[model samples]
Target: MLKKSGLSFLWLSAVAFVIDLASKYLVVKNFQLYESINLLPVFNLTYVRNYGAAFSFLAEHSGWQKFFFIGLALVISGVLIFWLAKNPINKKLQNTAYALVIGGALGNMVDRSYHGFVVDFLDFYWDIYHYPVFNFADVFICIGAGLLIWDSFKNKETSE
Candidate 1:
């Protein structure tokens, strides 16, 4: 079962990271704070900054959350790197999931470090309600989390 090493998939992580950063750069350059451009009835490119975790959790804190999140991402990133290095390459789903997560963590970490917040642009809304605006890093993280959940069910089935 142990064929190649999971590190072989690290490129996926890099790809995620680059895409997140590039998309962010484009948004930052082309939009101002609170700017919104409707691309569809339910979607828009809106520039915003997230000061806390998902849904701006603890976003009202007195700035301590920034450092807290950065430190947390660092710990998570280290743990992911260790896991990926030791994981067997045959576990494609697991490794790919981890890689995407690493990329997301790194992307947000850099944003928190350099800009004090995560850049958010994608926005979806109903006629009068809107979901939280998010970016590519969040996208990658969510996708990774979904894959992890799927892998867990799959592994459980195989084991039983």
Candidate 2:
């Protein structure tokens, strides 16, 4: 069943997850909290921990957000696995997207569960204003989301 399904793409998840964890490990080992290393005028490797969701949403809460996010990630991972198992292997784009999401979701979930926060390092900024600090998991998730949108449009085009 799953052996012949999009579950075949699960390796992509492992890759994303491992890269994310490894990057975080390096950051945690070499830098203190709030440490920043300028890599370019617009980019840096900064260390920060998020106890909330994207853009530090609900970051000011009284610790409940950590459990909530961890639970949410778990649910998302389970649903993605079910979807991959149900989808055929021919759904390459969709499967790839799902696998990436699973990896990103689980990567963050592991951090949230173990450290009570997600370690973010990569920082991209213009001159003054800076985007939210993020990690490889966020990159993978954003890429996966973009691919999902692209896949939807591709499917719509084929159906017409």
Candidate 3:
């Protein structure tokens, strides 16, 4: 069971990494920064590079933000990997969530380490209000977080 769980985590992580890298590559190769291709009335693919954490927070910090974020991601990823290794195999959902997080963090870490920023392409806007541009890795990270929350609630209810 432990071996199976490890393999499952590895497989999911690989898939997530590939998807994130491929999307970023396509965005970089096919579109220039700030170029928008409308896919829906409310959604578009806008090439962007984010140098900070989620939602572009601290994006304007003087230079040091890159090293800070990269170091933070590495620490987070290492913790998640350790947790996943320690967790019981029966906790499949929890392990999967950890895998998603690890994958997403590593994906963005790759960008930050190599390109000094994450390449974001997906964009959503309603009238004049625009959400920050993000990419597939962000989606995985958000979904993983939601699932982890749900799993925690479920376990709490089960225990009670």
Candidate 4:
């Protein structure tokens, strides 16, 4: 059995998964394909299924790319979980970031494995400039990566 803190990490992962899945489900059910519902001056909700990597990279591939990416996500998520286990529990922010990344990766990986793609519904744009359509899982992964980068910079500054 794991300790309380370890259990907490697991719980966080579960929460992330639930939230990611729920949001994606809502988007898939409520939005139409290629339809944009503007929420803010610079944001819109548009349903899109990506069969490739971040920003739909390699999306044009025949089909094998889906499984390739799914396998990659699984491997990456596994590594992140292992690292989370070894990390100190007192580092709440770091652990949370890891949990987010792991959950997000798994979320998209599920879609890619089962549906051959990920359902992205959130779109940001300003006139001609448009950001990639993304989902909750992407948000978590991006935020986690940002946090990790910030932490790395902080540590470097402290050590120097």
lDDT of each: 0.93, 0.94, 0.87, 0.83
Candidate 4: tens digits of C-alpha lDDT, residues 47-80? 8889888988999999989878888888988888
TM-score of 4: 0.89
Off by over 4 Å in 1: 1-3, 157-160
Tens-digit lDDT track of model 3 for 1-160: 2353443575787889889999999999999889999999999999999989899988999879999888887898888888877777778889888889878988998988889999999999999999988999999998889889999988876444
Alpha-carbon shift of residue 5 in model 3 (angstroms): 4.7
Model 3 deviation from native, Cα RMSD in Å:
2.0
Candidate 4: worst 10 consecutive residues by lDDT? 2-11
User: How does model 2 fare in lDDT?
Assistant: 0.94
- Which model scores highest in lDDT? 2
| Model 4 ranges off by over 4 Å | 1-7, 157-160
- TM per candidate comes to 0.94, 0.95, 0.92, 0.89
Candidate number with the higher TM-score (2 or 4): 2
In model 2, which runs have C-alpha deviations exceeding 4 angstroms? 1-3, 157-160
